[model samples]
Target: MTNHKLLIVGTVAALAILVAGGAYLSGRSEADRFAQCRTGNVAGGMEAFGTDFTLTRQDGARVTAAEVFTRPSLLYFGYTFCPDVCPMDTARNAEAQALLAGQGSEVQLVFVTVDPRRDTPEVLTTFGEQFSEDIVGLTGSDEEIAAVNKGWRNYYKANDAEDDQYYLVDHMTNTFLVMAGGATAEFFPRDTPAEDMARKVGCFLDAAS
Candidate 1:
């Protein structure tokens, strides 16, 4: 074939491939389309990861996961008394939330204390304010907290110590990205940077939308 004919044939083939790919994507379900946004895998898959639970908010009002997670939310499990790790992790989440906000994406920050004994509504309200005023701080009875923890598969234990007031609690430091309907979209490791978390969350949000 002539060079002009060859060029024309190549263009037609490219267009055909593009059309086929677009059709394939359009035929996929919403979950399949958003699957590309996933960075890591959960043990039993995302559907089995998160569950709804009732807990008290910073304002001392009882609320459920569905109510607090009315939008894309960063859910964390930690304590106000945590000397180092919790503070750093929550600060990173706040930073990520701010980044998303600047890019026109609104996400809620949820802090569920593992040390409910010391993290009352008043204490949580003060702790949450140190990061973001809009942060949702949740605490509840031991049973309620345990149920929520079990639903999320969170591991936390209080240390055996002589001084109960100053004792530290051992807990997981992962931050979960939960969608509006209580579906856990993803999770970030303790070392994940704010920018990286924001970018991943943004990808998920875009895919979901």
Candidate 2:
């Protein structure tokens, strides 16, 4: 072939390469947009709340953190005997779950007891049933509970009980919304309204889906 013919062929090949490269990049950009794999970015890094945990479920079943967080979930840290704050907060969470269920949303609620000594699996099972059958009440050894709490950056302390009849637990009053696969999480105050909680959880579900 003549030199001119070879030059024309080379130009066509280069153009094809550029077009293919552009298409690949465009496709990758779209994938990244929808992935949303890590949204919990902060001053340090994209790390979010507790990634995984293991504890005894209300029914005395040993469940891993991975199992519980398979879908979008709401986690509330409190004990069964919490007289005022815990009861009220858990009740509110149950109401919010009801609201979401009405809209056909499938978000799970998890109640983790910071006071593990008195809140055994049996006690947690009974306490969780009072709110909703869907709630998973969790209790673990003191070390296990503490490790989980540290992962969540939550704090709690046991107050004195009179005659060991009733006790108070001072704990963080924040509930956490963990996205599917436990990749990200957001915090909401305990007093967050049911409507708002439902709306926010719906948004997270929509995004995850």
Candidate 3:
């Protein structure tokens, strides 16, 4: 009878373990969980945010997403005209890239303008040079810019100005660190220090090599 009681207890314990495991799995967000290999992380029952795009490079050539994201890249979306936030954020991103370079990881810094009308190729090229000559400044038609922005879950709003041509654009400032495979593997908040950002990026660069 003692042996029989022990078996019953063991069975109940096994069932409890199974229930707990199921609960843990069910509670996780899709992005928080791992899925098949074709896509990046699977979150919310869908692939995580990395997408392909075609836009005009600052050099006046049309480039596809794969071409731009060919290597590990830091993507920032803002207009060159911003008096403050965009410049500061972009400078910080450039600093992080320099930090990564110091550690032997070459990460491309690609700046995409949300204000395409005002940010022509020449304008973007000049603005980008102020940060780093290596930076790739991209501008596209309005439709192309909107599509890429939507895919990346980035937001920008043009504030009303008496002269619409000189309006201010309020945009999201998170820097997206896309892995080599063209998938948005990580994102660093605007406030993240260069050292901290480099440490996070190094993890991926290390693994890639």
Candidate 4:
């Protein structure tokens, strides 16, 4: 298999193990609080995945996770220069966001760039608008971006290209549903359909409410 396929398979396997281990250790009965909303298990429940960090918005203003995740948000990490995977994955997220809006559930869409050196705020802004007006594109200094990536446990590696402006980033493609206060409700893989994503997100929203 190619490196990209191998990376995806490895990530899925790792997450599956984490989820299973967390479920086993929690020892909670099936009568959990968000039990009805959960279509699948999370590693350690709602708070397993997210962390506190700051990033620069497309407008070049710095914002904290608290400010960004004021609502149920779909958060993704990718670069604007990514040739194909990032575009398609983020478009899928936008479609899911639209579906939720039509059903009267508002969700924020956040895209953070992993390639901070290349993805300036202006570049990110243009890229995000191609997907959705409400999409909040974010980039930060290299240190800041690395911190957030570490917090989210996402992978990203930039290739050493002869042309600095043209390069590809290999990164994970998991879209996280993070609620207010940075608690992750669920995570959707790259291949999840928009319809399924909308349904699952609605379940979390309803259960939260």
TM-score of each: 0.85, 0.78, 0.77, 0.82
Q: Which stretches of candidate 1 lie over 4 Å from their true place?
A: 1-28
lDDT of 2 by residue, 47-159 (tens): 44685788999888999988888777789999887778888888888888999999999777889998998999889988988888788888999899998898888899887
List model 4 lDDT by residue over 124-168, tens digit each. 989998999888888888899988888788999888567576878
Instruction: Go through the candidates in order and give each one's C-alpha lDDT.
Output: 0.90, 0.80, 0.83, 0.87
TM-score of 1: 0.85
- lDDT string for model 1 (142-189, tens) is 999888988888999999477788889999989999998888888889
**Clash statistics: count for each candidate:** 0, 0, 3, 0
Q: Compare the candidates by TM-score and give the number of the best one.
A: 1
For candidate 3, lDDT tens digit of each residue in 1-209?
69999999999999999999988877763344322222233353223565688899999999998888879999999999999988998899889899999988899899989999899999999999899867889899899999889887889988856779778998999888886668776777788888888887887676555
Higher-scoring candidate on TM-score, 1 or 2: 1
Ranking of candidates on lDDT, top first = 1, 4, 3, 2
Off by over 4 Å in 4: 1-31, 42-46, 161-163
- Kindly indicate the candidate among 1 and 4 with the higher TM-score: 1
Best by lDDT: 1
Kindly indicate the candidate among 3 and 4 with the higher lDDT: 4
Ten-residue stretch with the least lDDT total in model 3? 33-42
How displaced is residue 8 in candidate 1, in Å?
41
Give the true-structure RMSD of model 2: 4.6
